[model samples]
Target chain A: MAAAEAAGLIAVGAGLAVGLTGLGAGIAEGNVGAAAVGAITEDASLFGKAMIFMVLPETIVIFGLVISILAIFVM
Target chain B: MFKRSVRKGNYAYTVTRVKAKKSHLLREEDYDKMIQMSVPEISRYISEAGYQKEMADLAGKYEGMELLEHATYQNMANVFNSILGASQGELATMVSAYLEKWDIWNLKVILRGKSYGLTGNGIKEDLVPAGKIDEAALDKLISLESIDDILNEYSRMGKVKFPADVISDYKESGNLGVIEDYLDKLHYQRLLDSISPYTQPTKIFLDYIRRDIDVVNLRTIMKLKSEGIYGEKVMKYYIPGGMQIDSKFAQLLANAETVSAAAGDMSRLDVFEEYIKPVLDFDNYDNKAVVSAIKKYQEDQAKKMAHMYPLSVLPVIDFMVHKETEVRNIRVVARGVNSGLGRETIKGLLVI
Candidate 1:
C-alpha cells in the first residue's frame, strides 16, 4: 500500500534468503572442510585440490547472496 | 566390556588417515626390489621404508631374518593399535571388534603351543598385541599351566565358555583344530551381537565382514575337500554370518567330491569366484594355489570397497588388510631368500 513498507518487506525477504542459504552452505562445508584438511595432512600436495573441493559448496551461499542483492535492489 | 555410541563424524578423519597410510603400503615396485635383494638387504630396505621407527626398538635384539620378522609383526600390531586409538565411539567399537581376529590369532598360537607342550617363553614371541586383549592378558594366558585355566581366563574376559566335553575331546584327540574352530565361531558371534546390519555406516562394515566370512568359508571348504575329508568334517569349520554363500552353498561345497568342483560351485555363487577361475586349475585343484587365489580376491574386494565407500570405515579396514598382507609377504620373502629359494619362487608366494 505504501512505498516505504514495500521496500522494508523486500529487505526482509532478501535477508531471510541470504541467511538461510548461508546456513545451509555452512552445514555443507563442514564435512568437506574436515575431509579436505585430512587429505592435506596426508599429502600437502593436495592442498590446492582439497581447497577447491572444500570451497565448492560455498557456491550455494554465493548464489543466495546474488539473489539477495537482486531482491534488495531490483525488487 | 564393549560399548557402542554414534561416532559417524570420526569416519572422515579416520578414513583420511587410513588412505594416507594405505598409499604408503609396499607397492609392486617395492616387492620387485625386495625379491631381488638378499635377506639382510631386504631387512635394510624395509627398515629404511615404513618400518624404520618400529625397527629401531627391535634391531638390537634380532638380526637378519629374525629381526625382519619381529620388526614386521611388531609394526603390524602397533599400526593396528594406533588405528584403534585414533578411532572413536561406534567406529572404535566396530574396529575393536574387527581386530579381535588378532586376539583370536594370538590365543590360537598360544593354545597350539601349549598342546605341543611348548613353554610360555616360546609362545610369547608369537603373540601380536594388536587387539583389545592387552599384552599382560596375553602373557597371563600364555603362562597358565592348563587349557582349562586358559579357558577360565577367557571366561573372565567375558568370552564364551567352551564346553567341558569339547576340552576333553581336544585332550583325548590332541586336536587343537576343535579349539580354534570354537574360538572363530565365538568371535563371529560377538561380532554379530555388537553391530547391527540395519544401521548406517555399520551396514557397509557388516557387508565387508560377510564377504570376508565368505572367503574364509571358501578357503576352509577347499582345504578340507582337497584333504579328502567330507560331509560333517567340513561343516565343523564353517563360520556363520556369511552373506554371499549361505549354509546351503557351504553344505554343497562340503559335499563336493573335489576341490575343483567346489571352486566351480563357488564361482557360480558369487562374482568373487569368477575372478578365482583363471587362477584355479579345475583338474589340479592345488590347495595352496586356491588359498592364495582366495586371498588375492579378498584383497581386490577390499580395494573395491575402499573405492566404493571412501568416506566410511572401508578404507581403514582395507588398509589393515593390506598391511597384514605386506607383513606376510615380507616374511615369505625373507624365509624364501634365507633358504636359498629362487626369486621367481619367492615372487610366486607374494600377494602383490
Candidate 2:
C-alpha cells in the first residue's frame, strides 16, 4: 500500500511538470506568433525571421517533457 | 449588480503592423531629393512611393500643387482609417477618440465654407473624412444650406452635442473664433474623459496628453507675446490641464514684459531648456522657426515614449504623428518648389 501511494504521487508530479510548462509555452508562443504574423503580413521577406521567433519559446516545453520522462521512467 | 469585464486589445499585432508602416515613411534623403525636383516630378515621386492609388485616382481631376494636396489628404485619411480598422477593444476606443480632431477640422471647414458661400463640392474637396463622422454624414452636412442647419444635424447624430449658446454667440459676434475655440477645448475635454489612468500604459498615455496640452498652451503664450498682447486678454485663450503650464504659471508668463523675458522664464522648466528656449531666444524668435522647433520636440517625445513602451498605444500614436509630418513635409516641398522658393527655404520649412 505504501509503495502504491508513493507511485501515485510521483505520477501526479510528472503530469503537473509537463502540463504547467506546456501552458506556459503556449502563452509565450501565442504573443510571439501574433507579432510574427503581423510582421509577415507587412513584408513577405520577414517570414523566415518571424518563423524563428515563433519557435523560440518551444524549447521550454521540450525541457519540461524531458523532466517528465525522467520522472516517469528513470525514477 | 453585474461585474464589468476588463477589455483586452491586440497590442502585439497592432504595434508590429504600425511599426512596419512607420518604416516606410520618407527619410531625410527623400526630402532632399524632393526639394530639388519640380512640382510634377515631386508628384510622380510620391506617386511611386506609397501614394500610388491616391495619385492615380486624382490625377485626371487636378494638377500640380492641387494634385499633391488632394492625394496627400486622401492618403492620410485612408491610412488613419486603416489603423482604426485594425485596432480593437481598448485600442480602438483610444485611437478613434484621438482622431476626432479631424472631425473638428471638417466641421470648421464646413462652417467656414457655408459662411463664405462656397459650393458643396468646393467645401467637400477640402474635408478629410477620417473621423468618427463618415463620408456620407459629411456629405449630408455639406448639402445643408445654413451653418445652423449643419450644427443641428451634427448634434442630432448622437455623438457630441454643441452648446445651444454657441450658435447664438456666433450670430452675435460674427466671428468663428468663438466656435473654433470651443471645439478645440471640447476635443481635449473628451479625450481626457475617455481615458482612465489606472494601468502603466494608460498612465503614460495620460502623461502624453498633458504634455501636448502644455505645448499648445506654450505656443499660444509665445504667439501672443510676440504680438505684444498680454495680461488679462491672454488668459482667455489659455487651455487648462497642461503638465507644467497651470493657470498660475500662465499668469506669470503672461505678466512677463517681452517675448525674450517669457522665453527666459520658460527656460527654467526642463522641457523648454533643450529644444524650445534656444530657438525662442532674443535674437531668433521667428514664428516659423519657433513652430518647427516645437514640432521637432514633440516628435522626439513621441518617439521616446513609443520606444519605452513598444506594446502600448504610443507606437500607434507615434506612427500617426510621423504620417502627418510626412504629409506636411511633402506639401511644404510641393508648394515651395512650385512657388520658386529657394531650396534652403523649403528645407527649413520641413520637420524632417
Candidate 3:
C-alpha cells in the first residue's frame, strides 16, 4: 500500500475503535447511571457505591481512547 | 400488542427510588411497638412516620379503624402514583397497567357499598385513587343508582370492557359474588393481554403475574375444601394463567379432601413446596390461617423476584405488595388494640 493510504487506513481504524467503544460505554453507563441515581435517591449512603458502579463500564471507552492515541502517535 | 413496545425502561433510577421507599416501610419492630400502643398512640406513631401526608390530609375528619384504613389506602395510592410518575417509557406503562387492580378494588368497594345501601359519599371515602380513572369519574360512578349506570359510565369513558348482559343478569340474580369474580377474571385477563413474554424482563413479569394467580387459585381451593364443598363447582372460580396450577391441576387440588392433600398436590411446584408445606400441618384449617400462610408465601416470592430482577418492574410491584401488607398490618393492629387482643396475637396476624 502507498504510505499515505496506509496512514489513512490506520486513522480510520482508530476512529472506528474509539467510536464503537464510546457507543458501547454510553449504553452501559446509561443503565448503570439511572440505577445509581435511583439508589442514591432512596439512600444517600449508596452514593459512593453507585458512583463506582456507574463509572465501571467507562473504562472500555478509555481503553479505546488509548488505542486511538497509540495509533496516531506510536504507529 | 405490548411486544412491539418493549423498549428498555428507566429501571435503575426507578428501582433506586423504590428501594429507598421500601426501606422506609414500617419494620417488624415498628409493628411490635405499634401493637403495644393505644389506638391514638398508633395513629400518632404513623403520623410521625412515613404516613404524615395521608394523616395530615384526613386530619380531624376521622379516627381509629376508619381513619387508619383511609390513610393506609391513600398512602398506598400516593406512593404508587408517585412511582408511576417517576418511571418513564415502558416501565410507566407496565406500572400503570398494574395499578388498574386498584381501580378494580375501588370498583368492588363501591359495588359492595351500594348493594348495602351505602350513600355515594360513604363509598367515596373508601376509594383508592391510584389508577388511570380520575377522582371525578370515581365520584360519578359511586353516585350512580345501579351497577348498570356504573357500567354505562365506564363504557362511555372508552377501552374499559364490561359485559352488560352478564352483569345485569348477576345484578338480577342478587349474586355479587359472581359479578366480582367476573370482574377479577377480566382484570387478570386484561393484565395478561398487556404483557408479552417475548423479552426477558416481560417474561419475568409474566411469571410473577402467573405466580400471583396460582396463589389466588390455591387459596380458593383451600377455602372451598375447608368448607366441605368441592368438585366441578370450584372450577368456576379457578383463574387462568397460573404457572404452577392450571385448570387441570386446580381441579385435582379441588378434589383433594383436606388442606394437606391439596397442599400435597401442589408440593411438586417449588413455590408450594417451600411455603405451603410448612404451614399445612396446622390442626384446624381455619380459613384465615390457610389464607395467611399463602399470603406469606406470596410476599416471599414477590421479594425474591424483586431481588432477582432489581432493574425490572418487579421491585416496584414488590413495593406495592409490601405497602398493601403494611396497610393490612396497620388495620390489624388498630383492630387488635381496640379489641384488647394481645401483642403476640396481633403480631401473629401481621405478614411483615
lDDT of each: 0.81, 0.86, 0.82
Tens digits of per-residue lDDT for model 3, A1-75: 699998998899899989999999987887788878877766789889998998899999999999999998899
True contacts kept of each: 0.54, 0.61, 0.93
Against the true structure, candidate 1 has what lDDT? 0.81
Off by over 4 Å in 3: A36-62, B1-6, B156-158, B256-274, B277-283
lDDT of 3 by residue, B1-352 (tens): 2343246567877888988898888989899899889988998899887898888888788877778878988888888888988888778878878888888888888889988999888888888988877688888888789877776776675267667776777868987778778778877887877786777868888888888898888788777888877888888899998988888888898887777666656777766666666666547667765577777877887887887766778888899889889888898899999999988888877887
Against the hidden reference, what TM-scores do the models get? 0.85, 0.93, 0.88
Flag the better candidate by DockQ, 2 or 3.
2
Model 2 per-residue lDDT tens digits across residues B1-352: 0122125677888889899999899999999999999999999999888999999999899988999999999999998988888887788888888899999999999999999999999999999988878899999999999777888887775277778787678889999888888888888888877777877887888888888888888888888888888988888788888888889999999888678778667876556877776666566558777888888878888887888778888899999999999999999999999999999999988898
- Using DockQ as the measure, the top candidate is 2
Q: Among these predicted structures, which one has the highest lDDT?
A: 2
Sliding window of 10 residues with minimal summed lDDT for model 3 chain A: A34-43
RMSD, one per candidate, in order: 3.9, 2.5, 3.3
Worst 10 residues of 2 chain B by lDDT: B1-10
Shift of residue A4 alpha carbon in model 1, Å = 6.0
Which is superior by TM-score, 2 or 3? 2
Candidate 3 residue pairs in backbone clash: A34-B13, A35-B12, A38-B16, A39-B16
Comparing candidate 1 with candidate 3, which one achieves the higher TM-score?
A: 3
